[model samples]
Target: MNLTRTWIALIALSAGSTALAASGLTGRAFALAVLALAWVKAELILRRYLHLARVPAIARGFSLGLAIFLMLAAGLALIPA
Candidate 1:
């Protein structure tokens, strides 16, 4: 609920993801899923920690940026180029 707990949860999620990647399950689909989760985490931070919802425009912009970055990075990583 609070920022600290949210951060801790995010860290835990990331660590778990890293462990999964290390376990030889690394695939583009899984990585894309992780990126989606990253976007969710970012939105949570903006809403819960930054109180972005208090300012609708800022909230939208911040979340949009987060989504864009996640999608782009994850998509690129998923590519075999």
Candidate 2:
């Protein structure tokens, strides 16, 4: 994606996350939804701004690592705290 489009997407995702936070939802589902939005925003920044899309192998590695970390975070978020 182009930088302009990526920027717009990031903005939209931020808006969505903010809306979700203000929607009075709670629990694991809400946490996962916010985290998913965060994942997309991170991916866009990584690919477009960081120019990682040109390197498919490195991009996949970073994306996979991020996915693993987010999954673990999601799991932890599900635990009572």
Candidate 3:
């Protein structure tokens, strides 16, 4: 719950998410994997660093929007020529 632990959680989340994305996963599978990782990270931040049990709905909405954009962009890039 300390700052040090929060930083470590963030790093671990980044590594785990990136590894999953690089492991030949695709489509909704990949998106869900990344979203799951993000949730893990968010939980840590909200509980430890933010100490904010009640995050604003706008923050969650923005996070969801970003995730959707990333998934859409990746899907488009993977389209056949």
Which candidate's lDDT is highest? 2
> How well does candidate 2 score on lDDT at residue 30?
95
Q: Which stretches of candidate 2 lie above 4 Å from their native place?
A: none
Task: Give the clash count for each candidate.
Answer: 0, 0, 0
Model 2: lowest-lDDT 10 consecutive positions: 1-10
Candidate 1 accuracy as lDDT: 0.79
Model 3 regions lying over 4 Å from their true place: 53-81
- TM-score order, best first, reads 2, 1, 3
Expressed as tens digits, the lDDT of each residue in 1-81 for candidate 2 is: 789999999999999999999999999889999999999999999899999999999999999999999999999989987
> CA shift at 64, candidate 2, in angstroms?
1.1
Q: Please give, for residues 1-81, the per-residue lDDT of candidate 1 as tens digits.
A: 877888898888788778767777667877876777677777877898888878999898887788788878987987895
By TM-score, the better pick of 1 and 3 is 1
Angstrom error at residue 65, model 3? 14
In angstroms, the error of model 2 at 14 is 0.2
On TM-score, the leading prediction is 2
Q: By lDDT, is 2 or 3 better?
A: 2
Local distance difference test, candidate 2: 0.94
lDDT of 3 by residue, 1-81 (tens): 678978987998899988997898987667667766776776666556765545667557655666686667657655665
- Residue runs of model 1 more than 4 Å from their true location after superposition: 1-23
